[model samples]
Target: MKRTLVVGVDGSPESRAAADWAAREAVRRDLPLRVVHAWLWQPLAYPLAQNRDAEARLAEDILKETEGDLSHRYPGLTLTAEVLAELPVPALLRAAEDAEMLALGTRGHGALAGFLLGSYGQQVIAAAKCPVVSVRSAHGRPVALPEQGEVVVGQQGGVADSSEVLRFAFEAAAAADAPLRAVRAWNSPPVYGYSLGPMWSADQFGGLEPYEKAALEQALEPWRLKYPEVEVVEHVEQGGGGHVLLTAASDARLLVVGRRVRESSVGVRVGSVAHAVLHHSVCPVAVVPHP
Candidate 1:
């Protein structure tokens, strides 16, 4: 179980793009790359000739093609390809259990439009043992990352559980030599109003904004000191966390979100904000599970 970056590929343009992203990421981390494709055999009612053989060949073909292209593109990089006879979610989860990070395509072949990430991709993201990054096809974004693009992360008021997410974002920014934007979203309590006048006007916020700004700064202070070379930007906005993070990540290189682990739950526990961003982020999205 040597450290490696695992990518799920299925011969689609989106998966290929994810593989490309993972290759570059592997190079960045100086780790080996593992490309995996999952295939399950379905038993026909009458069982004429089994298509299992053909499907297995196809899976091998996809794996080999990906391995060849990646090897050529990233010379001197260690890469392995595997075709697992298991369902996509379980297969990917197992492969990623020992990986530094798992990279997945936003959608698969014959994906329905309007869904930011396909169903299979979502399941894997919700269950992966390591950090999972959802990457879109090259055409999903412009050829060049936007000039204002940075590694944006949702700061959960600098909670102890969010340190992993913030650290991941800062490291990514440092790797890209880009800035890290920490966004903290807050909402003020609503006040009952009368027809004559509106209740709880802007003045009622009463230093709440400053308090949020201070909290954001305090959460980021240690990260800033540790990664002094990485420029840090703090944004405290008034709105739902999901919307704030989505808007800020529009031009970002990567959006990192944290998932708090709940022992009472049977599987990984993903919050509403993390779920929202996973379904709508324009750039690559990373989900880091934290206790």
Candidate 2:
């Protein structure tokens, strides 16, 4: 149960990109990197012995290739590779339980089409105990963290709900020596044609901006003090949370968002804003689970 940074690889271009990103992050965090590939044995149509052996060999090859590439790039990094003989979703979930963070590559269809995450990726992100980062490869290769770009994080709710997200964002920014942009979005109260009582004033809607701005600043105060080296940019906007965060992260090196752990009869759920950012953000997206 050693804590390490884990990256899942599937021999796809996107997974290669994720492995590269995870290696860099591991170096930054001073943690070992574990490369994992899950191979689900499918019954062959003819049930040939060679087919099964070939499949197993391919899985090992994928791990070795990824390990060699990453080791070449990060010679000082401690790394290991393993192939799990299980379904991907459960294998990844188990791998993430003891990991500091888990990184997975998301397939990007096109610039405007956004990322396409399979059901397994969604399930893993929803249930992982540690933060899950969805990385998209740019130009069929790994996208480097921008030197001047900030680490943008969507901040909402109170300190209790947002503290984990902020902590991750600040630590990422501090590691990269980049600025941290904290964004909060608010919607004006809906106007009612008829006022029920004098307690309801039309001026209340216009005055919400200041209150929201103050709340965002207050929530960020402790984090700012804790990571004094991280330059913070506070953004308060009136719009949809997802859209606001996406716009702020247009030039970000990393975008951090929070997913509240909610239990349902069916399964765990990722919040709407986090879902949207995961699909559309151009930068690497980190979904941190919080209470």
Candidate 3:
């Protein structure tokens, strides 16, 4: 694994917290922390009317200002800061490609209270090229992954593909010493199976509960194959995906989910699953980008 760590620094209190957390992660993982700040400049209708040099300078200043506490707080972690003129997400995405893990703070957008992921953290988690760790500003002081807590994987069974997800999930499970619960949610009535037609008997759906449970076992196959030493607690239930994940996240340490992969494309899809978890999970979420 690439040992370099990357973090998004946006001059907000949350971003500052993220830097502190990221530094601690670097120290824990024995890696270097690369702090990145992105700034966007609006253009005029006619063309390059106003200058962006000033904006760039201000962005650089913010990066410097964000480093205030690192010398005293995180001296051992190697810190590198850069200012990009592009949008936050893409800039951070490029940074993540070379990083083993990307750490970020949860910043809220809507009027709702508490420390939820803001727009920037949501975007980064969705499309990051590597595992992106979304840290809560109000929790986990040192920013390390939980040593003894739940590691819940948002499993949707066959709907979500790839053993990579399970691999990442189990890796977290091993790291936390927390029992891993492979969660797969199923609800009544097909959400969009219009062409499949209706079922004949309620007993037909009776097998679904068992089938879902078996699917969880099947999903665990590759994970077990890779890491037989890691023990997992399988959770196959019927409910909404986001709700189930969040409910399972209660007092949990780390919630792991795969970045939604498109059918034909190489990049990730930043879909509702990611958005929902990023904006709502009480604990930090680890978004494992599809490889």
Itemize residue pairs with steric clashes in candidate 2.
none
Best by TM-score: 2
What range of 10 consecutive residues in model 2 has the weakest lDDT sum? 108-117
TM-score of 2: 0.88
CA RMSD, predictions in order: 5.3, 4.5, 6.0
Segments of candidate 1 deviating more than 4 angstroms: 46-49, 110-117, 137-148, 191-206, 263-269
- Candidate 2, residues 255-281: lDDT per residue as tens digits? 999999988887798889999998788
- Candidate 3 contains a number of clashing pairs equal to 1
Q: Total clashing residue pairs per candidate?
A: 0, 0, 1
> Across residues 1-291, which tens digit of lDDT does each residue of candidate 1 receive?
568899998887777878888888788777899998887776768947766677678778988999999999999788999987787788899999889899988865722121124777877777777899987644454133233579899988455757888888888888778888899998865554333232233234456687677777878888888999998888989999999999988889889998776644465547799889977777888998777
lDDT (Cα, tens digit) per residue for candidate 3, span 56-84 = 67667777876666857777767778876
What's the CA error at residue 167 for candidate 1, in Å?
Answer: 1.1
Stretch of 10 with least lDDT, candidate 3: 108-117
Clashing pairs in 3: 107-118
TM for every model, in the order presented, reads: 0.84, 0.88, 0.73
For candidate 1, the lDDT comes to 0.79
Worst 10 residues of 1 by lDDT: 193-202
Measured with C-alpha atoms, the lDDT of residue 100 in candidate 2 is 90
